[model samples]
Target: MGGLLLVAITGIALVVGISVGIGDLPIPLATTFSAVTNRMGWTAIELNRIHETVIWDYRLSRALVAVFCGAGLALSGAILQSLLRNPLAEPYVLGISAGASTGTVAVVILGLGAGTISLSAGAFAGAFAAFCFVALLSNGARGGPDRTILAGVAASQLFNAATSYIVTTAGNAQQARDVMFWLLGSFGGVRWPEFALVSVVVGFGLIACLLHARMLDAFAFGDETAASLGINVGRAKLALFALTAMMTATIVSMVGTIGFVGLVVPHAARFLVGPLHVRLLPACAFTGAIFMVLADIASRALIPQQVLPIGVVTALVGVPFFCLILYRYQRVS
Candidate 1:
């Protein structure tokens, strides 16, 4: 029943996204569908150039990007929360987003590199670095979820300070504006190749997390119980951590640090479906994808002739949702 519900929500989200894109122009639904069919070479119907550009080039790419980003972040959050046994655990909670932002900012401000090695590469490097630092700090000792969360908080603050300093010292208004936009996240420059890369990475991560769902459940009872069950807790944690970091890095590179989807979506899934990782993981993924698609549609259509940064739209939507979740959790407790 939960799976069916998730599928229904995702289907509705897709329809709404398509409608929003079509409504952006004077194009009717039939015309929009015809344009899409023409692009897919499914029919002899002809579409005007305006319909083609709006439907094929801009809206489709933006909507697909939102789906991927939302799924990736939500899945990442579910894994991290399970591994750390902390409700607040998320990709951004550990400074991965901040680190990625720092790397992207450096690339934009300094003109430091070229081609694929520029912004995306830099963001990946920074995210990996932050992951390693947090892992090192959390290793050994009685490092539970609380310790991990603390380590992530420290790392995130440090990275944010560095990124701020770099932006301010550059002192170029244009560069600052560029940095600001990237920091806030946008789906403006999404292309087929970029989407393909993100899809591959996110797919692998989702598989890894699902395969280890039992192990994650075991860990929820603590490391000793997992070890007693013949699960190598240490090895499992390391592998899951690496997978999450890689997936998060790929997304941060593409989207520039959208937040709260991971934090908010997983909790909402948990509220509806309970905390079995096997069920929760997939639920979170679908819910996240739907949430992000709606957010992206609003971002594009909320203002005419001006595209709002997707991250801003997500934060605006997510923060209030998050607060509501907290209140509900508190009431239950």
Candidate 2:
């Protein structure tokens, strides 16, 4: 019932988002849907070139990217929480976001925007490096969850310091502003080719993670119990770690460091559904998609003649909700 309700809410939210996109535009919802259907060859209806271009080229691409980014982050959070056995476990918890930001800043600061290798590539490299470092540290410690969490905290702080130094020393004002905005995150300025790349990476990663949901459920019981149940705990963890790193890197590369969707959405899903990975993972993905789409809408519509960063909107929404969840968890405990 809970899962069904979540799905229903997400569906409603998606519809609302589509309607919101039509705001202040000359396009009607029926016309928009007709344009989409005609494009997909479901019906033979003529669309004005302007309306078709607006719906197909700009609004649809942005909305879909928002959905993909939200779902990917939430799925990554679910996997991390299960693997670490920590409610607070998220991709950003281990300095991956900070590292990615630093690398992006490096690209902008050095004026390295030409060629196939851009700031996105640099961010991916940084995120992957940070993930590897944290994974090694987590594995080396016999102390388990606490040690892993501590290592992540330490890493996050170190990487943040590096990011700060780079921002302060940047020579050009435009470069500094660019780096700052990237760190804040946005879905604006994204093109179709970039969106397609992100979709492929996120889709593959989500499928891979869902395939191992059963192993994750076993791990939730405890490492010893998982081993007893014939699960190769170490191998499973390693594979998940790599998959998550790749996904996180891909997202951070494209969208910059949007935090809390991964951390907050998974916990919210777990609160509604139980700790069962099968139910929890899909619920988290759907809810996260809803959350981000709404956030993106709010970001665009909140101010007149100015667009806000999507990260700022998410942070505003996520921080209060996260605090509420923490309060409830403490009360229950």
Candidate 3:
């Protein structure tokens, strides 16, 4: 586990460097290193102001935000899949993202807060609302995994419909344009503050999930088995749900809803490292961080002089993988 974490961190450093170096400006890897070291006061070497400004003010924050968003979403997915015993479970699929989008739209478009409530707060509130709906529909902790999954599907549709009604009927043209763009996802507008929020939220999420790793393993065999093992199945399920919701909401609010990271990354990580949440959780975070960074790079490079949406890039990769998973599951059953 120690060696795996070291490799993962090293990989993150290398990939984040590559991300900073690429772009319209195309700074060299050496220059990127100097800019970072100089900023940290490790070296006092002079560098071009433009390079420094771009790296510190813009690209660095964006890359870091991508890292946390990916990790948070993947961690949430892993937790959900284990607890629900559903391979297809994820925040987006479970209506958390849709609920967050609705909440954020209410705040931004309808001015729900009267200029006080921040978008992130609204998104979190909205995500919590979705969780409530799912819980109510599924009968809370008593619902079996299949029942909970069905509830999630219903909640997703309900929130999605609400979001569309608000955007089409309530928001003006400019707000509509902005909301549409945001729905697709972008790291373009994110800066240091956004990175700070995501990092703190995702950090707490990873730690919390790790501490509950043994409980999660018990959950995989079903709630009754977990209860037999003295795991408070109901309480544990609710706690895990809330944790996943908070993490998902924060990421959605910061970067818009980037899908597939949660759905795809957890499964990939689980495959590379066997089940057993202690090891699987870290593998998920690291793999997710790497995947999102690569996807961010692809979003920029795919269409020269024009950036594609991050969600689109992920979907392109995730859709085929999704089909493969479905096929395997079908064959297994």
Best by the lDDT measure: 3
Ten residues in sequence with the least summed lDDT for candidate 1? 15-24
lDDT of 3 by residue, 1-333 (tens): 788889999999888989998888998888888988988889998899999999999898889898989999999999988987878778887788989989999998889989899888899999999988987898955786567878988988998899888999999988888888888889999999888888999999999999999999998988889999998877888899889989998888877878778889999898899999999999999999999999999999988999888989999988788778767766886
Quote the lDDT for 98 in model 1.
85
Task: Please give, for residues 1-333, the per-residue lDDT of candidate 1 as tens digits.
Answer: 766876766584555446445444756667766776677789978668887777776666666677778888999888887777677778888888888777777776765575546666787777877877787788733686667878888889988888889999974877777767877888777767777888788778778888998998898877788899999887998898777777777787777779888898998888888988888887887788788887777776799878889889988977787678657655766
Q: Pick the candidate with the highest TM-score.
A: 3
Misplaced by over 4 Å in model 2 are 1-13, 16-26, 111-121, 133-147, 167-171, 328-333
The lDDT of each candidate is 0.78, 0.76, 0.89
Candidate 2, 21-72: lDDT as tens digits: 5545656667777876787889988777887787777777777777778888
State the lDDT at 298 in candidate 3: 94
Candidate 3 pairs with clashing backbones: none
lDDT of 2: 0.76
Clashes of each: 0, 0, 0
Q: Give the TM-score of candidate 1.
A: 0.86
